[model samples]
Target: MKTSKGVKRRRVEKDGDAVVATKLRKEFGGLVAVSGLDLSIPKGTLYGMIGPNGSGKTTAIKMIVGRLRQTSGGARVLGEDSPLSARLADIGYMPQEMAIYTDLTVSENLQLFGSLYSMEREAYIKREEALLSMVDLSERRDSLVSQLSGGMKHRASLACAMIHDPEVLFLDEPTVGVDPELRVGFWQNFADLKARGKTIIITTHYMDEASRCDIVGMMRQGKLIAEGRPEELMERTSTSNLEDAFLEYSWRDSV
Candidate 1:
């Protein structure tokens, strides 16, 4: 698949360089949403970012996706500069809010998003059908998004985000309103993506879900307080779960 700019988009970049963020900072007036934060995500791994409200989770993602300008510092996606040109096809973003049109049916929304990349008609159908199946929304393809439940809408939104089969996926609180069963399914889907060598960066306040990540970055007051494998973080902080580890890290940071 290729973006409208004629950049060929692959399912996974062969020997793709992991994401790198160096001193990434974003400020708004007197408030610094992201403060000299640095991060790295390996290809084919699931990375989780967790923090309390206003800890810069969403702000960081917005900066990465080019929705907001950084006050200072820099970042790179797929080895290119932050907000790489014509790199939209290399990224699939699922925002916290459902970005799909409420009046459009699931299939219609998928088709519309597919057209955004100028995907070929037959190719679009294949990709759309595959995505709908992966999201378990095939049965509801003709249903209006407004009539679907919160979980269903979220699933639809996810499918639309990947309409172009991006190599890197940025999911901001993907499973927020999903039920436990659905959440588990979502994790399974993420694992599947990992198997295909897709780099995934997920942000959430959910501790339990953070455990599913290969590495977790705990953000505090617009800074990355700690980052490591889930078990490594727990052991280093002498805590049993990610939530407690985050609190322990925060207390130490304050000291």
Candidate 2:
């Protein structure tokens, strides 16, 4: 394949680093949603981006997944330039908003996404069944998504995103609206995904969840203020938790 720059491209393999972004930036009419951000995520690692609302976590993920184009700089996913057609199939994205069909049955929703990837009937069926079990929605498979509760809908949305078994997963506030018990289940699922050699990038506001990540990028005011393992961030700040570590970084950035 050839890029617009006339450079030949290589097929992105499923191993090694999964994402690389350099000076990535995004802007609206008069607002800059992301500014001079750089990111790198390795294969099989679970990385988290944590910040308050409107801090650009969603915007960054959108650009990486090709939903929104960056205003400047560049990013490469799975070794190919991001937003490239060849790379789309290897990426799975679940936005903060519900991205499933409300009128479709839980099973139908999963089937719909599986079909989008042109998955074979047998393969789709196997994946759909496993995902339904993982999300603990096997009993709700025939139920219309509209009839499901908020947390059920969230789980269903996640099932849809994973139906194709994409190599890279981008989830934004995936645990929001979920009960504490279910949140633990969700994290366990995340850990299982990582164990299976999938690279996962998640955005969350939950400080406790940040500790579960292999690395955490703390965002504030459209910029990444700190990037390190959760424990490293805490130790550097002399704080005992991610929340206080983030506050320490915010205070340093302010002054």
| Most TM-score-accurate candidate | 2
- Candidate 2 ranges with C-alpha deviation above 4 Å: 1-15
Q: List candidate 1 stretches off by more than 4 Å.
A: 1-16
TM-score of 1: 0.90
RMSD of 1: 6.8
Clashing pairs for model 1 are none
* lDDT of model 2, residue 77: 90
* Model 2: lDDT to the true structure: 0.90
TM-score per model over all chains: 0.90, 0.92
**Over the stretch 91-113, how does candidate 2's per-residue lDDT look in tens digits?**
89898897899999999888888
Error of 1 at 195 (Å): 1.0
Model 2, residue 242: what's the lDDT?
Answer: 100
